[model samples]
Target: MTNKHSERRVVVIGGGIVGASIAWRIAARGQRVTLIDKGEPGSGASSHSFAWINAGAKEPIGYHNLNRRSLEMWPRFATALGEDVGLRWGGKVSWETDPVAAEQLQARVQQLQSWGYPSRQVSAQELAELEPALEIGPVVAAEYSENEGQVEPQMVVDACIRRMSELESLILTGAEVIDFDRDADGGIRAVQTDSGDFEADTVVLAAGTDTTTLAAMSNVYIPQAESPGVVIRTTPLPPLLHNVPVVYAPPLGDGRREIHLRQCADGRFMIGEGDQESLAEDDTQSHADDLLSRAAQYLPGLAEAKAIPVPVGWRPMPLDGYPTLGYTTETPNLYIALTHSGVTLAPVISQLAALEICEDVRADAVLTPYRPERFATLTEEQVAEMAHPRAGHR
Candidate 1:
């Protein structure tokens, strides 16, 4: 079959990074694409994303390899979009304070090295040298991966959507997809939105946390767990750390926190803490204060940094904590793209999803493990049990 995806009326639901990327790719292939979103592009999870682009701590060989491949594709993707999406390949450094956790961290690093990943252990002195602004704490062990990267996720989404528009793809903001109009043979004929119904040859559901709800409307079951996360952005500050991102796993205690901090191209630091235990009861300012307090331990400059109004978005994690990609067996014309690392996986997933939809080819070899059919027979209770106990963060 030819690679041309010409004239196919492809309607993409969701205007976040993933959806924007997919719509852009499809439109690039000469497909008639329409992107629908409840809000402006990137204002959903894309806006609140940590935006770290790395496969450093990803588990399982398959998942890690997938991320690695996508990481490699990012630069080329950005270049194609021809926009400054704040894409940076400055690498990443991570460390653990507890001895037990340090051992575990080192072991994981070694395993990644064995898998051909560029990850290596570093001493506290080396870490300090790499990040001069960091106030090195008690680190049992640390690892540095030069291949890691980060991006301004919202900027990337905007770039993709802008390119999609240039390619003649229709973009609908503040238009929500309410349901799907199915043909007699059970294929999606058109997408019913709050604004109006739009006919499409194929419908792709890239809605972040709402993916499960949309899939249910199509008589398909794509189980996703509730994984709420908070990211606090500080007002523009003088450069605090080196270009690279830093992940600190403090000693495990009742009140100890895991903190990740990285600076954007504009000099603003995006700092966030893991686990919801530190979240305030009713005040987001208190949560931001806690994040800043934790961040100051590593970068002393953040002690005086002011917190900005950042949106807290829930991550769309599949029940088994992996991406649920590919189309449903029953609804052949309906494709699903749901995952937590939308920032990291956007480029590759968009390319692959576009190819499958436009060429009508099966990507089973590359996406078999993540297909939605894996959960096709599960009951609602069984699906709920698949969710992680922690149930939050990426």
Candidate 2:
């Protein structure tokens, strides 16, 4: 393995939010760093996401805690980047459209409260008072978290790339890393790219869905769950939904999907995840109208949201529907950071993982329980046996 004590040269594959953030953090610590992207930085799944920095959205107290840590780091990260990534901390409102969903929402509120995050239920009257324009359904209940927020995904990538370059880190665009070569001792030496051979003391694969292919190059199989969802941006409207806004409708239980409606700072309200389909691969974009049609069903107010611009992307879904984050057991220097919540946790993970790489520490201890390698360790039989342990696992 390359000596951590020696001056290090690190190459990060995939220049999305995670990769760029990692490169920025590593270079900020005075290390030699290079970030390579096949296309433009953050133009991939990073920029295509909902762009919400929601700490309380995660289920299970552990996920919430991880998000809380990320939440604490976000302010410092935004200030350090010193650019307006359209970040807003106006809080979020999550709602349900079924009595059962209301019960579940009540339970989730209790869970969030137990974790010391302030989330409380709001009545239909309170909900109406909060947003007079919102047309609540017959079975609507809401839980509001005051600290949640959103950001423009593209702006975040732009700021991080500029900051990484300013920190003197090599930012390589349009460089696709096709393969990686590891020496006899299991150390990554050179990454074979379309351009040429690029060498580094360490390699971190934050390649989003492509991480699976890169790990396969290293003979490691990482389980991936891909979900294709739609996001529609409406024409800029008046500040209809105030603060960090979100609306949720319960699953009809007919194998359809639930809804998470969000309004962005740019006067665009994005409706997504109403017709969740389990994605087979991350090879193609999804059909936008399928999701948009579903959104129109949940939100009667959406009929008036004009000129909706639709975009579709895949969120890396682990088998458990939670994020799989950590380094591989077979390769010490080969690190993996795959999560749908990358936007929310980009700054935190970058800061923590950079500390681990630069300081010779394993910050993976924090997220070790959720390691991608967990799937690697399980036999095919085991995975088949334990599939879908939790309802609405996402």
Candidate 3:
């Protein structure tokens, strides 16, 4: 399809992985693209992300399908960017020890299997064979999905930005978007940033947590929940297991927390807790210690691993706990891209968003469920009703 706005100027706000991907893709299509960020690119949520590239545990079949499609596109996407973003597709291993949680895990695995997803329950022996380093304490059930993976999110963003520079796309840092300049017809004509105003035919708000604030400048309301999360990075250690991501949800009691751990390409292990207990405004030491202690139970190697917590960051989750993509009705030229799994969805979302913007085609068929208009008239009760069970501060 030929883009009607092939020669138009595009300004992408937010230099994280998603914005960098969009800017690079648009520039590749022969458009004049500019990328602006309030600080260094990928220093926000993208830097501190768990960076697990997976579709294994996503709920609502449609969301899972979207993630699966993105996982399929990641390899080519990484290759095109021409750098190692620490992309590893060793898959994932997860288990539950409690009977109730084990039953839930079985049902979830069955549901995934019914959806044609390559996920299956594994026996204790199979689990051992998959990850020898893990000490499965009374594992009632376990599963392994060969389709999951992980990435170094900061590396991906840096690679995309480097390619964007090679493409001669303008990149501005420390330029905070303050407002939008609109024409009489209510179409965006330019973006007003703290640095200055830049003219553009289209403006994309890919800023993670700041998306809502920017949308309001164009008279658009994008409701987002405040979900803060932290990731603890340990010093580089010997290879743990076979380079696979491991998720363990032990029996819930005595402050035991769900653990997510994966070794980066550089040999450093990234660990995160799934709990949402709030911490002191400036204190993450206690939380980091809790996470390391919990992980040490399963992997004794982590017992003495020094815990270095990454910067605290918040996920840009919509009210319904799903991605919000596509343009707005009030401002036709203003586009939005927000989600919790930014690392997993960056490539595909960027491709689809670029198509919609350049070709003047609506991707409603594929993105209908995640359109931003759903929250236009969304009521308080409706938001409460749509709250996801797993949706928490993180």
Candidate 4:
């Protein structure tokens, strides 16, 4: 490894939305950037997510503020980049059964109200008005956030890639990053790939589910739990539902899982559930029938809607439901960004990561608590030991 200061290049090891967003940000700052990926661009989990711009689940005023700020930042990228990105500003709904759970939702509404977001509790009548065809099974109450929205995940990533191309940032597909070599001063000098070595002054590991493997090459451990989410798209239907309805868990004695369903701009409806868990890598399975059966129970109109396609992907879930972002203590000039709601936060997170790289500081307060080193207190051996006790160690 050689001194990194000799070059002003940045190597982004993932070409998904996370890496593409960061590359655009770094390029905007007049820095040379190269994005490398093991497969075609935007074909990873970013393309597989529901692309829901969630707001209700993110409580605490600070987190809401981050979402709101990102919302403001999203349109600029879409408009300036001259791509549709399939971004729609439709609102979101969070309804639940169980009287006690309703009370908890009311508390969440109050919390959002304190944050100054227009989140209101709605009666069954209002819910029906919003979706006349919706079969609200015992869900008499709901919370509606007018500012929430959704986008076609792949479109967003494609738009980012187009923007990067326009900026002359090099993008290499089918490039597998095998190792990260640090200089004597502890700064990342180059990323060794199967094709060749690409030198860089900074490196960002935003490789969604694959981050843990990349971290191991640098001896940086990130404890990632894989959550399998299923997404199903229905055949085109006339515009029946105006707003996206996100129902919390337990679909009111119907023996089905709760999910959010919204009519896409193309007239198709998308349904999703995050209930499946996978212990092995490469465990991508489409639970389309389960999702469709449950979704049909909620939206009776879906009985007529035929199942078009189903896509399942893995979301990297960290302990405490938080993400690992920012620089790692194990290596310098090496950064990581992994989160469950990567689609919703990618715009802001990427901007913040690039800011830290270019300006030597991350001024975003929301990012202060999400540094990757939060897991530094625990070693991999310790975590393994805790998960599995020494069987024969007397």
Candidate 5:
């Protein structure tokens, strides 16, 4: 990538991890960038993120490879940020108590191994030795995904913002986007924000839940499913899991979901049940306490920890359960980036998005499956129904 786009102005809406990463990447590549956020950066869905960077759970060979590519780029990406973004790589471990679930786990591991991922079924002894802190209940079967890991989303966002500042990019917080100014051909000419107006050659809407509404202003349709998740935190405790960075303990009984636990760099444990994009709406103190107590069934050390209930955070879920990326047909210069695994996919997504915006090249090879135009045919009633549980649109 050269400085050919040095004269092009890039305006990024949304200051979450995705937007921040794209802003910094665009700015660093010599394009003039303006980052606009309605509130403090990284204070939205990112704050409530589990921050577990992984690819094992992703499906479909292409999408899995996309996440795996970004996962591999994390270390170098963190290095480029010039700060420790609390990236830790010890892999993810999970076990099952039920025989049926154990069979499912075995098959999952086999499929991952066939994909060349470093995932394999581990014995009960190996699982115990891997994380001696965990009190293995009745492990009928278990597996370890060695390539998966976790990171600090806020630290990653801050690092990107710092790099953008060093590149002389402008950042506006608490600046809601009121509207957009269109050019003769109907491309975004400028962004009208409460903070002020910012002219742009390219406008990237990476806003979390608001991406749909913002894109609709330009006649671009992007539908999203309601994804409310809760990942409660515990009061900062001493370093808990020594070897594995993440643990997926089996449910206590028949009617429970699998609980995931990971100790942050600050020693606070983030406990959440279900997959990264699973819909969990409970954020009450009782739910938080129950989550912690269930985690304690595996990691006895957490028995004394107090659960801190966080508000239910709505994840940015494209209707099809994949990323909505690249330029739209209605607005060629308007880029749409909305995804469920933004934290894990940030590195590769930002780099490719910057390439498309800066060099005037399309990343169709990797991003063709996630174009915003895919959602162009939805009916008015469908659009109305899919917009629920969304945060304020900019």
Candidate 6:
């Protein structure tokens, strides 16, 4: 192996949006790269994603800034990939009916405004004006974050594949990683997959929920909580939402959670209960129909739409509810890029991951707080205390 970074061989495990973006960026930076996926690229969790791109729901000033930076980077990323990727930027509209919920939303909007986010409280009339198609009933309070939007994760993954093709990168789907060849120093020397083996100077584990298991193979500790969510789809409707690309409407009937819906570029509508990281396991057709029924209460246009159930998608959530990025102390040659808002963070995260891999340097200022070493010393009590609480970001 050579000391030149560009000449080094890098193997990226996982072909989801996160891994695909990172691998594409690495190949673009002049590295010999191989991307291995147990299944077809983007057919896993990426396909089941709601693909909302926003920073309004992220808390803590630093994390909010991180998502906001990535949110802003999405456009340039789409352009660089040389594809549409269905990236929309009309923003999101969410309102609450209960007084308590309305107060919480208002406070949240104020906090986001204080952080210079584009979130602002809107009157019920303003909400109707924002998206007139909505039959928003009894809005106690409403907020419109004009910068938040949505994207097509599968489209983005396909675009990455198209660009990586030009970069001459090796992408193997249906090839599972059986083992790894390690050097005497216990560092990754090569990645062994069912398809074959590829020599690796660096390996990135962005395998979504499987990252915890894969990272453990390299003596790296990365724990993830089981976060299964269902975002049902509806048959194509003629542009359901007139203005905004994303909608978070209050739950109707006996529903205990809010229902978020967004129309995809392909004309299908994705509707889901709760937030991005909400826990759910039901993927039955009845559950899908139920979600659509709840959504139709707010958006009457969906009344005629047929429900399409999506398989439960597990979110790649770190135990402490933050991203575990950067190289591990146990295996310096191995990089970890696991996070929940992968769709929102793909652009900036991939650029930073590529810079670190190609230059053999740490993104200290940006990623120091999210290094894999943070979980090394966590106690069992701490793990439970910080377990995936509520979904991350808006």
Clash totals in order: 0, 1, 1, 0, 0, 3
* TM-score of decoy 2: 0.86
Q: Candidate 1, after superposition: displacement of residue 255 in Å?
A: 2.8
TM-score for model 3?
0.93
Off by over 4 Å in 3: 1-4, 249-255, 275-283, 384-394
Question: Could you tell me which residue pairs clash in candidate 4?
Answer: none
lDDT of 1 by residue, 1-394 (tens): 2245576799999988998898898888888899999988888878877788878767688888888899999999999999899988768888887788789888988899999999899998998888888887788899889888889988888888888878878999999899999989889999999999999988999998899999999998888766667777888887766556645546335565677778877878877775322342222887787777777877888887887646667777787877788889989888999987888999889989988887788788888888999999888787666765444322
lDDT of 2 by residue, 72-135 (tens): 7888888998988777776776677777877878988887788889788888777666656556
Candidate 5, 47-152: lDDT as tens digits? 9999988888888888989999999999999999999999999999999999999999999899989999999999999999999999998889999998889999
**lDDT of each residue in 1-394, candidate 4, tens digit only:** 2232324688888877788888878876777889999998788887666777765566455666776777667777677658787788757766778677688889888887887777899887787676676777667468777777777777777777888787788889898988877788667789999989999878888888899898878878776754656567778988766565343334645564466677676778777653222222222334555566777776777777776555456766654356577887778788887876777787878878877887787664668767777677877775665433221111
Per-residue lDDT value at 262 in model 3: 81
**Predicted candidate 3 versus true structure: per-residue lDDT over 129-246, tens digit per residue:** 8888887777888888888888888888889889888878899999998888899988989999889999999988999889988898888888887666777888888877574665
RMSD of each: 2.6, 3.9, 2.6, 5.4, 3.2, 2.0
Candidate with maximal lDDT? 5
The candidate that wins on TM-score is 6
Compare candidates 2 and 3 on lDDT and give the better one: 3
Q: Distance from true position, residue 338, model 5, in Å? A: 0.9
Locate the minimum summed-lDDT window of 10 residues in model 2.
276-285
TM-score-best of 2 and 4: 2
Total residue pair clashes for candidate 2: 1
Greater TM-score among 4 and 5 belongs to: 5
Residue-level lDDT of model 6, residues 55-154, one tens digit each, is: 8888788888999999999889999998789988899999998889999999998888889999999999999999999998888999999998899999
Q: Between 3 and 5, whose lDDT is larger?
A: 5
Which residue runs of candidate 5 sit more than 4 Å off their true CA positions? 378-394
Q: How close is candidate 4 to the true structure, as a TM-score?
A: 0.86
Specify the poorest-scoring 10-residue window by lDDT in model 6.
Answer: 385-394
List where candidate 4 sits over 4 angstroms from the true fold.
1-7, 59-61, 244-250, 274-287, 308-311, 379-394
* TM-scores for every candidate against the unseen true structure: 0.93, 0.86, 0.93, 0.86, 0.95, 0.96
